[model samples]
Target chain A: MIEIILGKYNYWIYIALMMIGFYAMIAKENLVKKILGMNIFQTGVILLYVSISKVSGGTVPIIWDKGGPYDNPLPHVLMLTAIVVSVSTTAVALALIVRIYKSYGTIEDDQIVVINSHDGDKEIPSEKASTII
Target chain B: MIELLDILLLLFLVICAVAAISMRDLLSSTIVLGSYSLFMAVVWTRLNAVDVAFTEASVGAGITTMLMLAALSRTKRFEFLYRKKGQQEDPNKETNPLLKNWKRKRFSVTKVSGLIVVLLTGAILIYGTMDMPDFGDPNSPSYTHVATMYIERGQPEVNVPNLVTAVLASYRGYDTLGETIVIFTAGIGVILMLRKRKKT
Candidate 1:
């Protein structure tokens, strides 16, 4: 147990981060916070992958000249794509948040759902008001 | 694989993540998340994954935070609590049941459900980690697999000097091409979603 805990402390730290992001995504009412939580969660996973590729006596993946125990370049290549995709995803999520705000005047998930629930009972005025606002 | 410096870096990372999540001000949290990415990038560099570190610094710290701030500029920065009595998404929808039931708030279903899900996930992840070869284990599956060949015969198979660049462009050319298309689609999606239309 002690060896598992101490020898693999890196995994535990990353797990803590992943849990933090997960909790925020679930518990936060603000839409922006949720987006940021997603970012945090992605970064934790990225770090986990990068850590797995490390070699104790290795140098960087660049092999321009000399040779040694270079770290696995596969995860690094894969995570480059992951990191870029993460950014693009964030841009899209933010765009959606903006649109949601324009339609509902607030981005809180609960409040938006409530507005939709009452829209049926009072339909026309809500439509007109949403456009006017 | 573990060092005192690495331990300190991870410590700072956890602290930043905790601060980013716990803060009520969304803007502050966003910037704190930026710093978390920065530190994580540094750690990746220390792990000899410079290419990953490069993208993390540029995309994670730079573009992600900029996008967050842009969104924040157009929205409220503080969290909305259920206890706030009169504030509503639509004033026209005055007869909302949630408003009437505010004082009688039975429980937050999302929070409880999320906690249950996250706990299960974290437990599974921890268990998964137990089976993974220890950090810097030379004979690990990842190293023993094609990575050995990549290190041994990389120079011969691909003319590119940088192994990461060679593998990314040559070995996984098709995957990277698909990713480029995905990014282009995302760019178009953003423009369509956020671009203001000329008023009719």
Candidate 2:
């Protein structure tokens, strides 16, 4: 049990981090909070990949005079691209959130749904419709 | 000693994650998320992933936070509990019992269901981790495959001191090109979504 805990605690902690993000993404009513959760979820996956690449007694994957042992470089390279993609995703999501706010006057997911449902029952006033257009 | 540092850093990460999600103010949550990224970068460095640490510090901690703050400037800062205009105007007005009950309680059915789903998925993922190799095991299968080839021949063939850069810029140049295109496409998408048309 001790050996398992020592060997796999990193993975367990990362899973906990991921679960927190997952809970926020699903349960949080605020749109921006959902986006924040998504960001945390992505970071957790990146952390898992980086953790997998570690080598005991290994230095960074930069070649020097003596270079027998080094951490895996592939995961690092992959995660570098993932980090950039994550930022790009965030930019797009924020843009959509801004547009959503412009139309609905609020960034809460439940409020947006309420507005949409209300739209079906009674036509939105002309001035509000103009802003949406 | 290093393992202890790793555990401490990860603990900090969990705290930051919880705080970021739980904060009522969106701006404060964004700032807390930035600190989370910063700690994540330090953890990456301790794990010998210097290149990834650099990217996480700049892109995750810096750019993402700035973008979130800019969005917050354009939107409301607080996650206000939204009530219908009718409810605000006349609290005594009769409404559907189900809707009224949901509005009164902080924890709705949606929240409880979401929590259940998240817990179920997390349990499955943790079960899957049982087969994974131990952390930092030098002879793990991940290090024995193409990773070994990349580390062995990367410096000699690519003539770059940093194996990560060598692989990213040369060995996996096509992949990097694809990623660059993804970023470019995302940029164009944001511009299209946000750009205002001239009055015609």
Q: List where candidate 2 sits over 4 angstroms from the true fold.
A: A121-133, B81-104
TM-score of 2: 0.89
Question: Per-candidate DockQ versus the true complex?
Answer: 0.60, 0.59
Flag regions of model 1 displaced more than 4 Å. A121-133, B82-107
User: RMSD for each model, in Å, please?
Assistant: 5.0, 5.4
Q: Against the true structure, what is each candidate's TM-score?
A: 0.88, 0.89
| Top candidate when judged by TM-score against the true structure | 2
Which CAPRI level is candidate 1?
medium
Per-residue CA lDDT of model 1 for B1-200, tens digit only, reads 47889899999999999899877678888889999999998998888988888888888999899999998888767665544556554322334355555332435888888889999999999999988988788889999898888877777889777889888999987778977987898899999998999999
Candidate 2's residue-wise lDDT over A1-133, tens digit each? 8877778888888888889998888888889999999999889889889988998888999999886698899999899889988899999999999999887777777756766765677655699779899
Worst 10 residues of 2 chain B by lDDT: B89-98
